[model samples]
Target: MSANHLEQLREAVVKMNVDEAEAIAKEAMSDGIAAMIMLKEAMIPAMEAVGELFGEGEYFLPEMLGAVDAYNKCFALLEPDLKQGEFEPKGTVMLGTVESDIHDIGKKILAALLQGNGFEVIDLGTNVPSETFVKKAEEHSPQVIGLSALLSTTMSEMKKVVELFEESGIRDRFRIIVGGAPVTQQFADSIGADGYGDEAQTGVELVSRFVAAP
Candidate 1:
């Protein structure tokens, strides 16, 4: 019965049914199903499936956004219990748009997806300077640092971030991934980024890989 309940919740999230997802989350809580179990077994997997659908071109931005909303609704219901349970995140990720670039729609989506996938995200917002990235990295020590830039002129700022980390001699401490409109695998390699993600889902998968790696 618990499995059935979790499965329904998963379906609701994956199908982008926000109200149904919230209702199922409430019911699951009332039924004494641990929030952590529901998150790990149902919600995370549902979001991952949503990512897969987006990658396969079966889901578009609107569908993916709806799925994220559903997941957020369910997560909101689970957060209190999760906090009380002392739920440790899968990992921590620091995200920001590069210095001088104010485009953050992609970054915001990436943050949401990362949160839904169980990573604790520290969003540094748009027009974040390289020094701020390094400073925050020292404070938070996230496993992954994601740099985003929507404009070609600001793409060079990602290189500055990598250079700053290298200059600080903490380059090896975190996996750095670069993305945005003008970012490419070649550019990432040239700028010494550990990985490149062309989209938000890809960015989440890259972070997951970095954290799961030995």
Candidate 2:
């Protein structure tokens, strides 16, 4: 593909132009561009740039959310084609914001990052109960189960999920990963979480490593 076409796709993503982005993605695929190449060369870089801007405070939550939404639109067009091929996920992850915490922005970003890296994420949404976590794990048999808690008080809820897993005798079944603003490595260790991340990117990486490990 020409540099211009690639640049157009990147610009569409950065500008949050969902329709244009999807069009560019479909056009790229029709031109015989590889889906993984489009994802790595175009979409992931765009989202990474947005994430950098977010870290720099140049882009706020609204901008980040808009960019993610646009990227999802582009992915929606490419995903069907990719799924038709022999696509193996990097890993399977089950994610949720723990009970009593209604915050979702962090969890949503984590989901996007995981998807960008080729993990199949099953998001359980906000205010998820401990039993739900165990039940979903039983159903999906994911490699990693991620719990998010933004509130200091709700941090303990991560422990509740862990306890529930132990009670179900499936604690050894999957690695439990935890993250959020109030979460720390120490806290994760204390709560019997297998991993902890300080940011969305790190959280995705952490799960990737845990799942990839033999």
Candidate 3:
């Protein structure tokens, strides 16, 4: 296949053409394009472009969701083709919402995107205690721990988890990232988090960078 097919695939995702993206993904796989290559060459770049569009105010929430939906369609088509354990993952990420914060959509989105980007993700679900995060981190020894909180009231719960790791002297073992509607860069810095994602897509990007960093 020509490079045009890859460009067409990227355009399909940028345009939020779900069916077309899936069809192209399937066709690309059949043409012997590796699933990871498809992800790195087409899907990720497409999402990056979509993120830029969103940042420019050219895309609204619905439009951003549409692009992500399109990316998900392609991901579903390519998922089974991904060989597990045959190659190393980008990184492992542990995710959870803070205790008393029952919201999960944001966490779920970040988990899925992280998985698509080749990270092994463990989603601890909503209302997760600081101890649970620490326990899981100890057990998994993940490269990153992602905290989510949709309520301002529960934001402090994220800080508690960070401090718990620090106090345990295991904080350097993994990078800490925080997100959700109530999360901010300032808040994350104040709590000693290594990174903050203002939104789901950007959060994935941040995690990717952290994992790839030395």
Best by TM-score: 2
- Residue 151 lDDT in candidate 3: 87
In terms of lDDT, the poorest run of 10 residues in model 1 is 78-87
In candidate 1, how many Å is residue 160 off? 0.6
Q: Each candidate: what lDDT? A: 0.87, 0.84, 0.84
Off by over 4 Å in 3: 1-87
lDDT string for model 3 (63-165, tens) is: 8789888887787677666534434678889999999988775676677667766788888999999999999999998888899997899999998999999
Clash totals, every prediction:
0, 0, 0
Error of 2 at 20 (Å): 2.0
Top candidate by lDDT: 1
Give residue 131's error in model 1 in angstroms: 0.5
Q: Sorted on lDDT, highest at the top, how do the candidates line up?
A: 1, 2, 3
For 1-214, candidate 1 gives per-residue lDDT tens digits of: 8999899999999999999989988988899998778977898789778878988999999998898889877876776665452247899999999988876656766776677678898999999999999999999999999999978999999989999999999999999999987789999999989999987789989999999992
Residue-by-residue lDDT tens digits, candidate 2, 174-204: 9999998889999999989999998877997
TM-score of 2: 0.64
Model 1 pairs in collision: none
